[model samples]
Target: QQPVQSPQAVILREGEDAVINCSSSKALYSVHWYRQKHGEAPVFLMILLKGGEQKGHDKISASFNEKKQQSSLYLTASQLSYSGTYFCGTDAYSGAGSYQLTFGKGTKLSVIP
Candidate 1:
């Protein structure tokens, strides 16, 4: 099943912060985060596996909870370069070549001056 994302849109000023969340209906083996700018393809941000661990950089971070089938992306120190639509992709690994990953509609984040 496709994961559900919260806050369909977000507006922030430069140097602000925001949080985007995603939840899945089924047990997830991995979660992917991506950012897509206008008229562009999504860019890989990070991935969280079922190990209940977190991964990220100084400006972006993400957490995944295997038991809750949920994940959250944190955008700190927001910049104009960070303006884009964020998407959370969920993956279910059943068996060999029997896996599927789906993403939510996405969260539009606009950072203004």
Candidate 2:
């Protein structure tokens, strides 16, 4: 099943901070965070594993809570360049020694001056 992202949209001023959340009903093997700008392909941000791993990319970070089947992305000191739609991709085992990825609807974040 696809994960669900919270705060479908958000507006932030430069230097502000924002948190985006993703949750799933089934157990997650990993959560992938990505950002896509206008008319551009999504760019990889980071990934958190089921072992409660926390990861960071520049000023952005994320944490995974396997027991809760949730993940959260943290954007610190938001910038205008950060304006984009953020998506969370959840990985699940498909029982064939492989995994499937399901992406959320995404959270749109607009950073203004």
Candidate 3:
């Protein structure tokens, strides 16, 4: 089943920071974050695997908490370019090392000057 994402929409200004969260009842094998601009395909952000943590980067980052069955996306020093809809795709272990992803509804972010 699809996970639940908080703050369906967010509005920010340049140089600000925002966090988007995703939570699921099922144990997640991995958490994939993506950003999609209007009329565009979602662009891959970061993926947090089980037993691991955030993939450190300059502006975008994320963390997976296996204990809480949740993941959070952090956008720091935001830019107008960061404006888009973010999605968290969660994969659960099906069987035999196979996994299937269930994507959250998506969080919309808009930036103003």
Ranking by lDDT: 2, 1, 3
Model 3, residue 67: distance off in Å is 0.7
lDDT of each: 0.94, 0.96, 0.92
As a whole number from 0 to 100, the lDDT of residue 92 in candidate 3 is 96
Highest lDDT: give the candidate number.
Answer: 2
Q: Model 2, residue 103: what's the lDDT?
A: 97
Candidate ranking (TM-score, best to worst): 2, 1, 3
Off by over 4 Å in 1: 94-96
Better-scoring candidate (TM-score), 1 or 2: 2
lDDT by residue (tens digit), candidate 1, 1-113: 77999999999999999999999989998999999999999999999999998999979999999999999999998999999999999999767879788999999999999
Candidate 3 to truth, TM: 0.95
Report the error of model 1 at residue 78, Å.
0.2
Give the candidate number with the greatest TM-score. 2
What is model 2's C-alpha RMSD? 0.6
Is 2 or 3 the stronger prediction by TM-score? 2
Q: Which tens-of-lDDT digit does each residue in 1-113 have in candidate 2?
A: 88999989999999999999999998889999999999999999988888999999789999999999999999999999999999999999988799999999999999999
**Lowest-sum lDDT 10-residue window in model 2:** 48-57
